[model samples]
Target: MKTSRLSTALLIAYGIAILGFLYLPLVSVGLASISKARYLSFPIRKYAFGWYEDALTSDTVRDLLVISLKVAGVVTVASMVIGFFGALAFARYNWRFRKTYQKLILLPIFFPQTVLGLALLMWFNALGVVPSWKTAIIAHLVWIAPIATLVVSIRAFSFDAALEEAARDMGANQWQTLREVTIPLLMPGVTSAGLFAFLLSWGNFPLSLFSTGADSTLPEWLFAKMVSGYSPLVPTVGMLTVATSAVLVFGGLILAWAIRRLRPES
Candidate 1:
C-alpha cells in the first residue's frame, strides 16, 4: 500500500510538472495579451480585449486563415483518397515487394519535417513550380497520407471479410462490393483518418513555410510574427486556433459516437 501510494504521488507530481512546462508559455501569452503594459510582465497590471480585436480584424490574419483552411481541406481530401486506396491494397491484397511499398509509404511519417520541407522546396523549384496553396496541400499530403493509410489499414484488419465475400457471391461486381459494402463498413476509420489529416495540415509549420505563397498559411503567418518579435496578439491567435481545434475534434468524436449509438444492433 505504501509503495502504491508513493507511485501515485510521483505520477501526479510528474503529470502536473509536465502540464506546467507545456502550458506556462501559453499562460504567459494569455496574460500578456490582456496586459496594459507595452511589454509582457508578471502580475498583469490591467486587462483588455484590444489584442483580440486587433488579431480578429487584421487583414493579414484573415487572409492567412483562409489559406490555412484551403490547404487543410485539400490535404484532408487528397490524403483520405490516397490513404483509402493504399489501405485497400495493403489490407486486401498480397504480392511481392508489398513490404517494400509499405515502408516507402510510411517513410515520410518518420522523416524530419525540416528535411522534408527543404527537399520538397528544392524539388518544386527544380520543376519550376511556384510555391502556393496547391504546393502546401501536396507537400502535406505526403506526410499525412501515411498516417491515414495506417489508420484505415488497422481498421481493415479488424473488418469482417465475410460481407465482401457475400456480396461477391451474390453477383455483385468488384466496384459494387467496394462501393456498397466495404466503404460503408470503413466509414468510421475514414472519418478519423480525414480528421487527423486536417489537424496535421492545419498546424504544420516547416512544410508550410517552404510551400506557402504570398498569402501565407496560418502557421507561416504566426511564425513570421514570432520570428520578428513576440506580442500579445500572438497568444490571441494561438487561443483561437486551440479553441477552434478543440471544438472541431471534440464535436467530431461526439458525432461518431452518436452515429454508433443510433445504429441498429444485429
Candidate 2:
C-alpha cells in the first residue's frame, strides 16, 4: 500500500511538472500574440486580433503551408509503398540476415535528427545541388518510411496466415490474395502508419530547415518567423497549427473506432 501510494504520487507529480514545462511557454507566447504592443512584452498592454489577421493575410505563411502539405503528401505516398512491401517481405519471407535487416531498417529512428539533417545538408552540398522542397521530401521519406515499415510489419505479424493460404489454395493468385485478404486486414495499420508519416514530415524542422529553399515546410517557415522577429501574428499561426494537429489526431481516432466497431467480432 505504501509503495503503490508513493508511485501514484510520483506519477501525478511528474504529469503536472511535464504539463507545466510544455504549456507555460506556449501560454506566454499566446499572450504575447494578442498584445497590442509593437514588440512581444509580457504582462501585455492590450489585446487585439490584429496579429491573427496579419498571419492569415501573409503570403509567406500561405505558401509555406502549401509546400509543407505537398512534401508531406509525397512522403506519405512513398512511405506507404516502401513500408508496405518491406512489411510484406518481413512477414512472409524467411531469409538470411533477417534480424540484421530489421535492425538496419529501424536505424533511422535511432539517429539524432540534428545529425541526420547535417549529414543530408553536407551530402546535398557535395552533390553540388541547392536545397529544395524535392530534397526535403526525399530526406523526410528516409525517416518516415522506417517508422511506417515498423508499424506495418508488427501488424502484419498478427495477420492470420490461414486466410492468405486459403486464398492462395483456391483460385486466387498471389496478387489477388494480397489485394483481397491481406490489404483489408492491414488497412488499420496502414492508416496509422500514413498518419504517423504525415505528421513526421509536416513537423520536421531540422531536415526541412536545412533542405528547403524559398519553398519550405511549415516548421522551416515557423523558424524563419521566429528568427526575423516575433510578430504578434506568430501565436495565431501556432494556434492554427495546434488546432490542425488536434483535428487530424482526433479524426484518426474516430476512424480507428469506426473500423473496430464496424468490424465483425470473432
Candidate 3:
C-alpha cells in the first residue's frame, strides 16, 4: 500500500513538472506583458496593462491578426477536406502504388520548413507568381495537410470495413454510404486534424517568412519586431496570440463535447 501511494505521488509530481516545463515560458511572457517598464526584466518593478491596450488598438497588429486568421482558417478547411480523402486512400483503400503515393504525400512534412519555403519562393518566382497571403496558404497547406492526413489515418485504420459493406448491401450508393456511415465515424479525427492544422498554421513562422512576400502574419511581424527593435508590446501581443490559441483549443473541446452529446440522441 505504501509503494502504491509513493508511485501515485511520483506520477503527480512528474505531471506537474511536465506542465511547468511546457508553460513556464508562457507564464514569464504573461508577466512581462503586464510589466510597465519599457525594458523587460524579471521581478518587475511596475505593472500596467497599457501595453496590451496599445497592442489591441494598433493598426499593424490588427492587420497581422487578420492575415494570420485568414491563413489559418483556409488551411483548416482545406486540410480537413484533403485529409479526409487522403486518410481514406491511405488506410481504407488498397491499390497500386499506394505506398509510393503515401510517401509522396508525406514528403513535404519531412522537409525543413525554411528550405521548403525558400524552394517554394523560387518555384513561385519561376512561375511568375507573386508571393502574398495566398501563397502563404499554399505553403502552409503543403506542410499541414500531410499532418492532418496522418491524424485522420489513425482513426481510419481502426474503421470496420464491414460497416461500409453493410451500407452498400443496404442499397446505399457510394455517396450515401460515405455521407451516412464513413464521414460520421471519421468526424472526430477530422475535427482534431482541423484544430491541429489551424494552430500549426497560426504559429508557423518559417513557411510564412518567405511565402508572404509583401504581407505579414502575426508570427512574422513579431519576428521582425523582435529583431529590428524591442517593443514593450511584443510580450503583450505574444500573450494575446497565446490567449487566442487557448480559446480556440477550449472552444474545440466544447464543440467536441456537444457533438458527442448530440450523437446518441440523433
> Every model's Cα RMSD, please?
2.2, 2.7, 1.5
Q: What TM-score quantifies how close candidate 1 is to the native fold?
A: 0.91
Q: Over the stretch 1-266, how does candidate 3's per-residue lDDT look in tens digits?
A: 35788899999999999999999998999999999988879899999999988998999999999999999999999999999999999999999989998899889988999999999999999999999999999999999999999999999999999999999999999999999999999999999999999999999999999999999999998889889887889988998998999999999999999989998878
Candidate 3 Cα misplacement greater than 4 A, ranges = 1-14
**Top candidate, metric TM-score:** 3
Best by lDDT: 3
Q: What's the residue-level lDDT of 160 in candidate 3? A: 97
Worst 10 residues of 2 by lDDT: 213-222
Error of 3 at 264 (Å): 1.9
Clashes of 2: 0
Give the 10-residue window scoring lowest on summed lDDT in candidate 3: 1-10
Per model, how many backbone clashes are there? 0, 0, 0
- lDDT (C-alpha, whole model) for all candidates: 0.85, 0.83, 0.95
Candidate 2 is scored at a TM of 0.87
Candidate order, TM-score descending: 3, 1, 2
Give candidate 3's error at residue 178 in angstroms: 1.2
